[model samples]
Target: MKNYWYRFKHYPFYQHKWFRISLASLLLSVFFFLITISNVYTETYSIERFTEAKETIRSPLSIENEKETERERRAAIQSVEDRYEISTEITQERVGYVNELFEAIDKIDEEENDSGQSGDDGNTVSDKEKAQDLQQMISPEISDALQREDLIQLITASPNHRSLGKELLTTSLYDVMNDGVTTENMQTGIDNIKEKLQYSSLDASLKEVLYLISEFAVVENSFYDAEKTVEAQKHASSNVEPVMIRAGEIIVTEGQTITNEIYEELKLVGLLSDDRNVYPLVGLILLILLIGAMISYEMNNYAAKRELDAGKIASIILISVLMVAVMKVTSLFTGSVNQLFFIVPAATGAMLLKILLDERLALVLSMMYAILASLIFNSEIPGSLNMEAGIFILFSQLAGIAFLVNLKDRMAILKAGIGITLVHILTVLLFLFLSFEKYSMADVFTYMGFGAVAAFLSTVLTIGLLPFFETGLGILSDTKLLTLSNPNHPLLRKILIEAPGTYHHSVMVANLSESACEAIGANGLLARVAAYYHDLGKTEKAHYFIENQMGITNPHDMLQPEQSAGIIINHPYAGGKLLKKHKLPKEIIHITEQHHGTSLLKYFYFKAKEQNKYVKEADYRYPGPLPKTQEGAIVCICDSVEAAVRSLKEPTKEKIAEIVSSIINDKLMDGQLNDSPLTFKELEKIRQAVCEALNGIFHSRIQYPTNQEVKEAN
Candidate 1:
C-alpha cells in the first residue's frame, strides 16, 4: 500500500499543471472583469425636464445629436439669401429700338432731299409728309409707340442736331438698362433715362424726341434664379458642423432645472438609457476572455516544456492581480487633466515576471495590463480609452523586457529600470508634443518626475519581490541559482570545510554539467547548482566516500560488502533531505535526489555474492525516482563521467570520450533517463560537451627542467 501510494502521489496525471493553470487564468479573468466593470457599466438617470436639485451630470458617450444637427442644418439653409441673375437679352433688345428709330428719321430726310420732288406737283415735300414717310420706314413696334407729331419734329430737325439727339438717347438707354431692373424698379429705370435726356445738349423738341425713345430702352433685366438659390442653400447646409454630445461633456448643471434640450442630450449620450449599459458590458467580457486566452496559451507552452508548477502558476496570478489592482487604484485618482496614472509603476510586474518567470509570459501579460489601464483610466466613459496611458505603459513594458538581459547578473533589473525610465519620459513627451493642447514648463517637469518615480519604484518592487519568490516559495530563479552557486553560501562553505576532496570533485562535476546542459538547451545554472550539492550527503561521513578519504585507508575495505553498499546507496537521499530542510528551491533539491538512479553498487554487490551462496542484488541499489528533467539527466551523466575520468592515472582525450560514452550507455541500458524526454541528437550533444570539458580539465602539462639543473648548465 505504501509503495502504491508513492506511485500514486507521483503520477503524472495527478500532478498535471493544466488544472491549476486554468484556474489561474479564470481568476485573472474574473479579476479583470470585476475591476473594469464600472468603466463599461451605464447608469440611467430618473430625472425629468424642469427638475432641479441634482448633481452635475456629464455625457457617458460620444455621439452626434442627430436632431440637434438637423435643426442647425435647417437654420443654416434658412440663413442663405435668395440669389438673382441679370438677363443681358432684355438690355440688348431695348437699345436696338432706339437706334432703329433715329436711323429711320435720317433715311427719310435723305430720301426727301435727294428726290427734290413731292406731293405729286413736283414741289418740295411738307414736314408732315416727310414725317409720314419716316414713320413708314421705321419698325411697326417703334412707330406705334411714338406719335406722328414727335416724328415730324425729329424729321424736320437739322441732320447734325438729329445726329446729336440720336447719340444722347442711345447713351442714356444703354446706361440705364445695363444694370438689372426689377419690375418694382422698371419705372425708375425709365425715369433715370428721361432725367439724362432732360439734361442733354439737345433742343427741347429734340430732347422730347430723345426722351420718348429712351423710355422704350429701359425694362426689367434682373430675374430670380431658382437653381442658383437652391445650390447656395445646399452649400450652407453642408458647411454646418454636426452638433455632437461629446463624451464627458457637461449635460446639466447641479441645482439647475433640466431643460428639454439638456434631457435629450443626456439620452443621446446614453446617460439616460439602461440598454446602453448591456452592450459595453458584453464588450468588456470579450476583452477579458481574450486576456484569459493569452494567459492560458503562454501557460500551456510552459506546461508542454514541463516547467509549469504550482509556484509559477501562483506567481503569474499574484503578479498580474497586483499590477492590475495598482493600475485600478491609480486610476481612481487620475483625471483628464491631472492623469496621475503617469506615476504608476507600470514596469514593476514585467520586471518581476521576466526575472522570476518566462520573458514571453511577461511580455504577453504586459499587453493585457496596458489594455486594462486604457479602459480603467477612461473616466468611466463608454467607448472611451485613455490611449495616452495605454501607449505609455506599453512602451514602458517593452523597454523593461528588452533591457533585461544576462539573467545571471543581479544588476540586470537596475539596467532595465533605467531603460524603462528613459522610455517612459520619451513616451510622455510623445503624447505632449503630438497633442494640440498646450503644456507649461511645470507640467513637463511634473510628468517627467512621475516617469522617473515610476521607474525607481518598479526597480525597488522587483528587487523586493524576488526574494519572496526565491526564499519564501522555493522557486529557483537564475539570480537565486547564482547566489547558491557562490562559494560563500553557508551550505557551500560547510561542504568545503567538512569534505574538501568532495568539494573539489563537486566543483569539477558542476563545470562539466553546466557545459553539457547548455549544449543540449537545458537549464545550465540549475545543472551546475545541482552538481554543487549532489554529494552534500558525503559531509555526514566524509571519510566513507573515496574522494573524501584522502591519505587514509579506504573505509569500504573494513566494512562488510552489504554494509558498504548500503552506505553508498543512502547518500543521494540524505543530500535530498538536507536540501529540503535548508528550504532550497525544489529544482535544486529534485536534481540532487535524482542524479543517481537505483543503479547497482557493482563492486560491493559482486564482493557480497562471492562470499555468500546468494546475495540480493536489490539490497545493493540506491533508492531513486529516476531523473525526470533534462537538467537532472545531464547532471546524472556528468557526475559519473567526471569521477571515473578523474580516477584514470593517465587521462587522455580518447579515454575521457570513451568513459563519457560508456557511462551514458550504462545509464541508457538501466533506463535511468527514460523519463527525461531526451532525444538521441541531444544526448550526442551532451556527450560531446562532457568529453570536451573533461579533456580540457585533464590535458597534458608542460615539463620544465629543475632550477638546479638549469643553474649547472649555465
Candidate 2:
C-alpha cells in the first residue's frame, strides 16, 4: 500500500491526469492534421470559363446545382404560351356596331322621305343629295370608310338588295368575330368578311360599301390576361425538377470545351475554389477529437490496472501512424470504379493491437481505423464518405478481433486472417446487393480478389511483425506465456527430469496461483507460467530441498539454521538469473524474483533461535524487496498455502481454507504484500479462489477394505 501511494503521488508525468489529457490532445491534433490533408488534397486544376477541360472531373458532393435549376426554371417558364381570356362582351359589342350601321342608313332614308315636301332647291331631291344625307346620318366610321360613289350606289339600290347586303355583312362579321381574334389574326378576320360579301348576289358598288362597314366593325376580342398568364408560367416552373449534380457525376470530359454551364456545375460541387475546405476540415477535426477521447478512456483504464509508461504510449502512437500511412498510400490508387481500398490490409492494426495490448482497446481502435479509412479512401471526393468502404473496413477489423480468440501461437493470426477475408467478401457483397447499379460477374471476382488479398496480407504481416514487438518492446503477451508454460520447453523439461518432486510442487502452485490471479483480475497466464519457473534454482542442488528429496534425505538436514535459510533465500535470486540468461520477458523474471519476497524462513529461524537465543531476524529473512505486483503477490501467497495444505494429515476443505487464510495473513503482517497494489477485498477473493482450487486438488476419495481384513471377516 505504501509503494502504491508513493508511486501514485511521486511519479511526475505518467500518473498525473494532465499528462493523459495532454497526450490525448497531442494524438488528436496529429490525427486531425493528417486527415485534413486528405480533405484538402487533390489534383490542382486551373479551371476557367469556356476553356477545354484537361481531364474528366467528377462531382465530389451530391448537391443541387441551384444556378442550373434556376436557368431550367426560367426556360420552363418561357416555354408556356401567353394566356388570353376571350371577352364575350367585346364580341357582342362589335356585332352591335355592324347592326347599327344598317339601322342608321334606314333612319336617314325615312327622314329624307318624311322631309320630302321639298328640298331647299325647290325641285324633287336627287339621288346624290339623298346619298349625302344618308352618309351624314350614319356613323362617321362607316361614312368615312366608304366612298361617295359606294354610298350613292347603296341609296340607288332597291330595298331588297340593300336588305340582302346588310344580312350578308352582319352574318359574315358575327361569324368572323365570334371565335375571338388577337392582333395577330385581325387581318384574317377582315379578309374573311370581304370574301363573304363578294360571294353574295349584290351589286359590286353596294358590296364594296358593305365590305368597308365590316372592316370598321371587326375588333380583337381575345385580350392578353396578365394574371392568368403568370399563373400558367408559375405552374410550369414548379413542375420542372430541380437540376442535381449527383456525387461522382462526370462534370467535364477530357478535351471537352468548358461551357459556361459546365463551369458552373464544377463550381457547384466545390471544385473551383480552395476556400471551401474549411468546413470539411472542421468536421474532420471534430470526428477525430471524438475518437481521441475514446482512446483516452481506454488508456486510463489500462493505467488503472497496470503502469502506463512511455513505451506503451509510444507503441499505440506508432501503430496508429503506421495504420493511417498505409491507408493514405492505398487510397492514392483507389477511385470510385476500382475501389482498391478493399485490399489495404487494414485489419493488421487491430490484430497487432490485440496481440500486444488489451482486446477492448483493439476493438475500439478498429472502429477508429475504419472511420479514418473512409476518409482516406473516399475516391478523392471532398466532404463525401465512402460508406461502403467504411462499413467493409469496420466489419473486417471486427472479424479479426473476434477470430483472434486463441493467442497460443502465430497460427491464430492466420486463422483470424481467414475469418477477416470471409467477412470482407460478405461486406462487399452486401454493399453491392444494396446498390442500385448493375454489377457484372467480373466486378464480383475483382472485389472478392481484393478481399482475399487483404486477408492474406494481414495474416502474413501480423505473423511477421509479432516478433519485432515481442523483442523490441519487451511485451509479455499471452502467447509467449503459453509457449513458456509448455512442459516440453527446455527449462520445464529440465525441472521435470532432474527434480520430479519440485516439478509436481510447481504444477500445484501453478493451478492455485492461476486461480488466485484470475479472481483478482490479474494476469493468470503470467502467474501460472511464472510459477513453473520460480524454483528453477532448485535444479542446481535438487537434493538440498525437501520436495526434491524423493528417496534420499535432505542435505539441509546436516546444515546449520543459517545455512538452510541462506540456501532457501538464494533460490529466488538464482531463478531470476537463470530466466534472464534465457532472454525471457522482464515480467516473468520479475515475478520469479519477487514470489518469495523478503519473508522470514519461520522453520529455519525458529530452529536457529532455539540454538542462539539472540539470532538476528534480518539474517533469517529473505533478501529485501517484497512482491511489487499483484500477480507476484498472489503467487507468493498461493506458494506457501499449497505447501502447507499438502503437509496436512488429510487435507479437507476447512483445513485448506484455514491454511490459505493463515498464509495470507502471515504475508500481510510480515509486509510481504505491502508493496503490491492488492486491496483487502482482492486478498479476500484470492483466499477463496485459492481454497476452492486446493479443495478440488485434495478432494476426498472412496476407500475399500484390505484383502486380509475381508478374509478375517469371512
Candidate 3:
C-alpha cells in the first residue's frame, strides 16, 4: 500500500488534479461567459437609452439610376467581347508576320540543299553553272536579316543595312586577326556574288543587300527557334489592350423595374448577400488558443523551474481565472458605457497577468484576453462583429504590457498604466480615421474618457490584488519586492540599526544589482531587495566580519582558522534561519541562503592551511544550493562584485570593469548563472551597469584634517 501510494503521488499526471480541474473549468466558464456577455451587450446596445440608432441608414449608392443594372450588364459583356476581339487580332497579326519570315527561311534552305545535291563526283562544275548558282543563291546574312521580323520590318519598305554592315565589318576585323573567320572565305563569297552581279552593280544602293547577306551568315550560325518564338510573343503581347469594368451602382433609371436574373447575379457576387452570414470566428478562436497556451506554458514553466509550493500555484491560477471573469463582466457594460469602456477589461487582465506572470507570457495572454472581450461585445456574424476594434484593442494592450517590463516601482507601473491607456485610445482613434465611417465626436470623447477610467481601474485592481498573491500565494512581484524592501520600511530600518555595517553594505550592493538589472531589462527591484536581505545572517555575528569590526582587532586572528571559516561559511544558512524566524517571505530567505552559494572563503582556508596544514578545501565553503530565483541569482552577482570592488585599495573604472566582468564570467563558468533568465546580451548590459555603480560607490573623497593635525600645521 505504501509503495502504491508513493508511485501514485509522484506521478506527474496525478500530482496536480486541482490544476487539471481548474483549467478545464476555466475554459468552460470562458465559453459560457462569452455567450452570456454577448446576449447582454446586444440587448444593452439595442436599448435607445444606451445608443440612439438613426431612423434611416440608407445605402451610400442609393442615388444612382435604377436602369444602372441593365446598362452595366450589357456594358460588362461588351467589354469582355471587345477584349477578346482585340487579343485575337493581335495574335493573328503575329502569326502572319512569323509566316512571312519562315517563307524567306525556306527559300534559303532550298537553295543550299539544291547546291549540295548538284555537286558531281565531288569535283567537276562549269563556271557558267557556278555563276548561275551564285546569282540564284540568297546570301546567308540577307536570309537571316529578313528572318528577324523586327529588323525586317524596319527595312521591309526600303531595306537599309548600313548598321548591320558596319557591325559585321567590326566583328570580322577582330575575327580575321584571330584567324577564326578567314579573309579568304569572305573574299570567295564576295567574289562569287560579284562575278554573278557586277562589282559596279554593288553600289551604295546594293550596300543594304551586302550587309543583309553578311547578317544572314551571322544569324544562321547563332539563331534558335526559341528566340524567334519569344520575339513573336513580345509582338503579340504588346498590342493587347486592358479591359475596364465599372463598379459601384448597378441600378438603372428610377422608373425601371429590376430583373430577377440581374438581382440573383448581384446576390451571388456579394453585392447583395442579404442572407448568409460570415462571422469573424477564426480570429476569435485563434486569439483564445494563443492566450490559453501562453498562460498555461508560463504557469507550468514557473512552477516547475522555481519549484513553487502548491498553494502558490493555486493562488496564481485563481487570480488569473478571476481576472478573466472580471473582464467578461466589464464587457457586458460596453453598451451603457463608452466604446472605450471595453479597454478596462483588456488592460485590467493584462496588468494582472504581467504582475503575476512574466512579461512575455502576459503580453501573449493579453492579446487572447482582448480577442475574448471582442467576441463578447461583438457576437453578430455577418455585419456587426467589429474585427478591427478587437485587433486594435489587442495590439494596444499588448504594447502597454511590453512597455511596463522590468519597472522598479509602483509609481512607474502606474505611469506605464496611463501610457497603456493612451495607446488603447490612440488605437481606437486611428481605426476610426482609417475606417472613414460616420461617427460622432461626442461619442469619441466619451469613449476616450471611459478609457482613462478603465486604465485607472486596472491599476487599482492590480495593486489591490498584488499583496494577496504575494503573501497567500508566496509569489514575489517586482512591485511587491520594491515596496517591502524600501530603505525607510519598518523591517528594513530594524535591519539597518541591528547591523549597521551589514545594512550599509547591503544598500550598496542593492544599488549595484538594481542598476545592473535595469540596464539589462531583468527584474531590477527583485535584485535590489534580494541584495538587501542577502546578508541577514550577519546580524547574528556582526562583530566577526571586517565591515562591522571597524578599527578593532580581528576576532578571527585569535580564533583557529577552521573555526573562523565555519563562522563565515555558515552565515548564509544562519541568515535564512533568521529570515524564517521573522516570517519573512520564502524568496527572501532563499536570497539569504543562496547569495554566497557554495563559494569558498579562500582567505580563511589558506590561513588554516598555513597554520595546521591539515584542512580540506570543503571546510571553507558555504553550505549552499546556489541561487534559484532570478532575484537570488542577481543578488549573488551584485554581492560578489560589490565586495570585490570595495576591497580594491584604489579601484578605477577600467579595473572595476575588468574585475566585475571576470567575477560574472567565473560564476557563469561554474554554472551558477544557468537557471537565471539572464541571456548573454543582458549580462553585458548588467556588466556596464555594475561598472557605473561601482565608480560612484568608490569615488575618491577629499580628506579633512583633524584638530590636532590642523594645530600642528599652524
Best by lDDT: 1
lDDT of 1 by residue, 136-180 (tens): 877887888889999887887788888887777777777766767
lDDT of 2 by residue, 113-215 (tens): 7676556454576877877877777777667777778777777777899999888877887787776788998999999989978888998878777777777
- Badly placed stretches (over 4 Å) of model 1 are 1-15, 78-87, 106-131, 149-233, 275-277, 432-442, 551-553, 557-560, 611-616, 703-714
**In candidate 2, which residue ranges exceed 4 Å CA deviation?**
1-5, 8-32, 41-86, 95-210, 220-277, 307-311, 409-411, 517-522, 551-562, 608-630, 668-685, 704-714
Q: What does the lDDT come to for candidate 1?
A: 0.85
| TM-scores, all models, native as reference | 0.86, 0.79, 0.55
Better of 2 and 3 by lDDT: 2
lDDT of each: 0.85, 0.82, 0.60
Cα deviation of 537, candidate 3, in Å: 1.1
Candidate 2 local accuracy as lDDT? Answer: 0.82
Model 1 clashing residue pairs (backbone): none
What's model 2's lDDT at 230?
Answer: 99
Question: lDDT order of candidates, best first?
Answer: 1, 2, 3
On TM-score, who's better, 1 or 2? Answer: 1
- Most accurate candidate by TM-score: 1
